[model samples]
Target: MKTLYKNYINTFKGLSDEIWWLALITFINRAGTMVIPFLSLYLKEDLNFSVSQVGWIMSAFGLGSVVGSWIGGKLTDKIGYYKVMVRSLLATGVLFIALQFLNTFVSLCIGIFIVMMVADAFRPAIFVALNTYSKPENKIRSLTLIRLAINLGFSAGPAIGGMIITGLGYAGLFWVDGITCVLAALVMIKVLNPKKAKVLDELKNDNPVSVYKDHAFLVFFIAMVLFGIVFLQYFSSITIYYKDVHLLSEFEIGLILGMNGFVIFIFEMPLIKWLERTAFTKLWLVFFGAVLTGISFLILNFTSWSGILIIGMLLVTFGEMVAFPFSNAFAIERAKKGNQGEYMALYSISFSVAHIFGHNAGLQLSAGIGFENTWYIITGLAFICAVLLFSLNRRLNNLKKIQL
Candidate 1:
């Protein structure tokens, strides 16, 4: 027993205090997401908004996210993650509090957009901090683990938000988010200590030198934008499929949707370790994983078995766990030293741009082409997107060897 106890304590003796703070910041930042995952339902069921109206509102939030990422990049370059994070959290909390007083659609929409602005901006700031905190020896794994923390919070936040909505209501969800935001601000204020930059260097801050001019970062950014379109479908296309099919009870649909996050939680860490070496190897694992995900949409249409649908969602989890971190890690790898904020923000734009199309067009495509066929089309398109990305990778590999 003594030897076992000593071994356990020995395991983490030299662990970086910085990583612990990163994890804590992650927990605090993500706890605010308790409101977002339930946002669709809250708009429709709680506030009696129409489906189209809901989509419009969601687009507003996405817009906020884009502006947030852009502003965060400039500001993080200007100041640092510490001030950006504190202000973002505090502002998000105030916006959530404002939601409690509004009943009008425009009121809710604008409020939600404002809140999303701050919430979304914090994301790149976080990516910047985490990317800087590690050496190359462990940066990929470090990035993977931090993403895992966010998903872990996202997995539980919805269920807990659901319970609160049931027990107390939408008002309750806001209160939960508001409380978390304030707490996150406090935690960041006290614990997220970053190394001070040289004063002269800080004073001369100009436009972040284009890391993209270097080829690897540019090609990776292009590929990530394509990947974004494929990945954004879960919330946009798949949910629409579930509702349009009407093949299950509300409870059943909830379970199916809920299972995606569940599988992500189960597989994320183990798979993160597995993919770390693989991404350094052939790079096809990431490609194959994207194929699995795109095909799973088509599979969901053919199967009625609960088991198959669950399995299909598992494939998405598998694909997601593979592609998402690697994509981010790939970006971080080629980013300019000390410009993790701008790199992450630029990377984030791909996801935002992808959704700009996915959210606005996905539903209309499903409506026009039929939901089943839309999956077929999407699967085909996903392959094309993947091909584009891989093509970029091949073209840029020679250039990548130049500096990085």
Candidate 2:
């Protein structure tokens, strides 16, 4: 027990203070992420929108994210991450508050698009910040630490959000979301002095390669989009499934979702630390993670027992712990060879693109083909994603050998 405890503690030994602060900021922001987990329910039950309409609005949310990621990437390259992060957070805070007022379909779509555009701009900028703040060897662990913070906050967010929805309604969610964004920004301003930080030198390449032209990276990008599509359903269609199929309440659904975060919060850092010390390549780990995610959804098709929900969530949580941090490290490493901001932007955009397709497609499929078939389809996509990542891993290995 002592040995186990010591090993777990060792996982956090080397990350910088800036990285810790970054994680704290992420925690503050994500803890108030009450609106998103329940957004589909809000539109369906409260606003009386159809599933199809909900899909479209979610797609609009993705469109905004794509644009935000692109603009944020460009600005980070030109002005630095510090400015981009502060501005994005502050703007997003105001937009969240404004978002609660829109009731009509067109207005809600536009409002969410604008809010997400501003909000998601923070994604790539923070990635760049991670690069600047972390030591080279500790990069992946640092990513895991930040993810831990996100999950920790997420664990709290949904349970609290469910209670808020039960008591004060969805409007309360919007207010809390907006306030947290503003608070996170203020903390960023008070804590991080970007001027005093040491920026790492990019890998020496007199002729830098554009992210658009990188064949290996393009393959990885496609895989990430597929992964995102499969993973994002937990937020969209899965919640609906929990509600309609299992006849769970909003608070019960929140607990199940919160369970995903809580599992990751406890297990991810140690798991990541152990994985890093192993001989398994990062992409191989990613491939395994993808397979596990596919299986998570596949199991849902087998049982209607609400108990299975916990099991599926556990599988997905472990898959997430294994997949995301390594994927992030891979992207950052690739970015180091060229333009960090642009590379990370494209990376963020891959998930944004997933958002564009994933939420809408999952909901539509659920509405059209029924939830069982939708899970089967999503399970198939997850396997396809795993195959792609496996191919990309081999391709990268071949390229490395050729270079040697």
Candidate 2, residues 207-229, lDDT tens digits: the string is 76899898889999999999999
Q: Each prediction's Cα lDDT score? A: 0.67, 0.92
Mark the regions of model 2 whose C-alpha exceeds 4 Å error after superposition. Answer: 198-206
Off by over 4 Å in 1: 1-15, 195-208, 211-219, 243-258, 279-285, 367-369, 398-404
RMSD after Cα superposition, model 1: 4.3
TM-score of each: 0.84, 0.98
What are the clashing pairs of model 1?
A: none
Pairing residues by index, what is the TM-score of model 2? Answer: 0.98
